[model samples]
Target: MDISDCKLLKVTMDFSKLNEWRTLPCPKCEIQLDIVLACGQSFRWTQLHPGIWCGVFAKKLWLLKQNEDEVMYQVFGGKTTDSTAELIDYLQLDVNLNDLYKKWAKDDSIFSKMVDNKFHGIRVLRQDPVENLFSFICSSNNNIERISSMVEELCVHYGEQIETFGEKTFYAFPTVKALASVGVEAKLRELKFGYRAGYISRTAEYINSQEEGEKWLYNLRMEPYDIAREKLQKLTGVGAKVADCVCLMSLDKPGAIPVDTHVQQIACRDYLPSLKDKKSLTPKCYDEIATHFRNLWGEYAGWAQAVLFAAELQRPKVKNLVCLPQGRKSTKMEEIAKVSEPKTKIKRKKIK
Candidate 1:
């Protein structure tokens, strides 16, 4: 389970031979695969190349790419059934994103000014509740890169291997049973999970003790947002913010806004000048901020929060193009050139 040995295996594999690539009518205004995949919503997706992303979701390995109007995808491993409906549900393409953008712009003046093509198509991902719950548990006071590494370690150690491409392998997220087994905390500590080790182990055991086990977590989707949030907080290591994240990302509650220090700053600086003097976010302050955004952005407030978060983090810029000129044909060299190239200024020798 030494994950460092897992090199980039897909770089050499032929993508076309696994399955026929299909297209879904996904415009950039509706879905920007580059931004949506890399944003903090999910940690599994890797941008194998510019405008092309690879990830495992919905129990399948996916190689996905997009243009201005459509998304192209190829599938490998898992069930061989049609994934069109699954993809739509995961992406939530049924929702009118363009309409939401217009509504958000109309409601907040700062948002109106900040809304640009770069941040467009940013949305909350509908992820697996079990996976989402554990992932965010690993997120407390941690950076995204470390969180991703921890998640992968969880998979590599306990989850079933999904597929093997030459020397490297891909794994699905571990099941509650796998994580709840004996000595999970000790094993996790050995892997350097720190104090969060106890949290994850106890939480898994708690879930497994439920009448229906993991199904109970899925059933949270049907409960009221308040009820779901309250229930999730009952587990070990889960607090208000973690519960809110589960509610927003997976439990079908678009209005559940998870407020962290970053969000607190955004609210005080851009929208609520009155709250600026408060030194820290108390329970009353947290509710005040969440309630304000819920009222301001309406039901899809979580989605709106994602856009602001991306801006606050100052996510790196990526090249976006609909298509090449009518007569200009794309070449392999051009594609390779698009990858980030290091820029350095050299002091040229003065011609004496």
Candidate 2:
């Protein structure tokens, strides 16, 4: 209930896309990440029958349509706190918005010029660096649903608690010490985390035990983001895409472009011979393609990729479009997907 350290602002922005944007279901489980995280506002966890400290005022980059202006609302931790203001003033989410508009204008890059001269919106919102690293590690070959599940499992079993969001409780993201406290291999598998368990535990151990963990990552920042990616490639279970995801989302490395399976497919479909064959197109071929994309989009490469990734993940399902009255729905209706999906039923909806 204490937010004395939080800042406040009243910038002109739109959130008309709040509901539509929140609809992006978790790719792995097909539930909504927003709903799982409680619309990015309530990251709660209940312990010992009482709600204790375990919530983070998180922010998400949203495509908000305000009147004629289609812009991003940095919704979450804001300049001020009844928890209402946009994150623009806080995270200082930045990139050349004008340049991004051009690139995202069409199937073409957001940088392309529009005939009407009205710019399409574009920008990047920074996230907590440490969380971003661990999150992407859960993301390898796995769907967003499974990734979110593993992350929640990681926290519930290890993270500390936050208390601001009432008895609505949540575990803190596990720290190096916290993560090292238990055997991740068994816990992760028991939670159905798939193969990522090994990577998660090994990475956590290295991060905690090494005297030079931060220094190692910090020094990578000095190199070009691609080179830094090469360094991370040496870690366990970190493939080209996973390393790039960490680079772009966590490190704020603009040149880092994560070529997820979706991106790989898009690349092959949109451009010529995008896929790398064994002899001619190796992993290096993929890197070169990512580099081409990074160079083409310039600085907002990471941000641009996020918007695209979100769009791709949202399979445009219209199977059940339940429009609730604008007034708040009771909290009980939310999908606690991350924590309970392993035991949850699978519901499929059609995209009308």
Candidate 3:
């Protein structure tokens, strides 16, 4: 349909140190696209088809300016435009440059460099809570490419489409009203949500009928960030790590730190030497391990943890987080493609 018929709302949020955070009219739906946890990677939404218009394709974001409260932003194309001038323009799309970065640069040191490296062209694009929850539920023991495929398949199968720019279709990350209102079992199978589909369905059914806010796990961004975190861990499929992720990205508890296996490995190796010799660890230990950094990195702790993990994974020594290769090490991308390879080969041979 016609997007011109709708009014758009834009809100800018500067997530302390992680990166730029903003939401604007989806070029398609004219609705707010809630992309959060501002960062450089957006494989969550764009992996299926490069440049594909689905009303949403998480783009790279940059900070135009940062005042005492907010940071203006723009999203750059990626590894290609890694310069200041280009990065600045990408963020100043509709704002003025008031030397905000320069002021922050006055205290130039390691932190400034960290901000320069991580903050420039970074954005936490908001996402639909239900979608983020489901997407993340599928995250445990999962890879990026697989996560992308699973989420996309869910949209294609169960989500409604928003007709936008040339073939642009967007799905509203199926709600309880949507999933419970429909055939969840078959939909889960179709999307390949895997074993957790039942748990996901259970969670949705429980929450959909309640007054549970989008911030239910986040406690409406009102409670002390820690308490909000406590509430998140109460959900199934959500351990200390998953809950922290939802809190950081959805609940605005920017301080929330998630410790998945990768982060756990890093913690024991670098920070938590005391926990090293001990065989059995508890959630309290994970919290203790993550909390130290949360304080160290300030509000950017979650982002820092993610960066540390991403950097470590690139080291070539780390194994897969969710799925490993049959005989060799595999990046998340390799693993996802591998999942469908045998089927693809049989189809190709049959056609030949």
On lDDT, the leading prediction is 1
Query: Please, what is the whole-model Cα lDDT of each candidate in the order they appear?
Result: 0.78, 0.45, 0.45
The segments of candidate 3 whose C-alpha lies over 4 angstroms from its true place after superposition are 1-43, 47-125, 164-168, 212-219, 278-281, 315-352
* RMSD per model, one decimal: 11.4, 13.5, 17.0
| TM-score ranking from best candidate downward | 1, 2, 3
Candidate number with greatest TM-score: 1
Instruction: Show how many residue pairs clash in every candidate, following the order shown.
Output: 0, 27, 16
Better of 1 and 3 by TM-score: 1
lDDT of 2 at 111: 29
Instruction: Give lDDT tens digits, candidate 3, residues 1-352.
Output: 0001111111221122222233221121111112111122222322111111112322232322222333323333334443333422222222211232233334333334434332332223334445666677777776555665666666766665532222234444555556555568566865677677776776666666567634353344577777876665566676676667676665666567776666777778766788787565577877788787765665546645544554454322211122222453333222222111111100111100
- Report residue 104 deviation for candidate 3 (angstroms): 13
For candidate 3, report its TM-score.
0.57
TM-score of each: 0.86, 0.60, 0.57
Model 3 deviation from native, Cα RMSD in Å: 17.0
Q: Model 2, range 36-59, lDDT digits (tens) per residue?
A: 222111222111111101124342
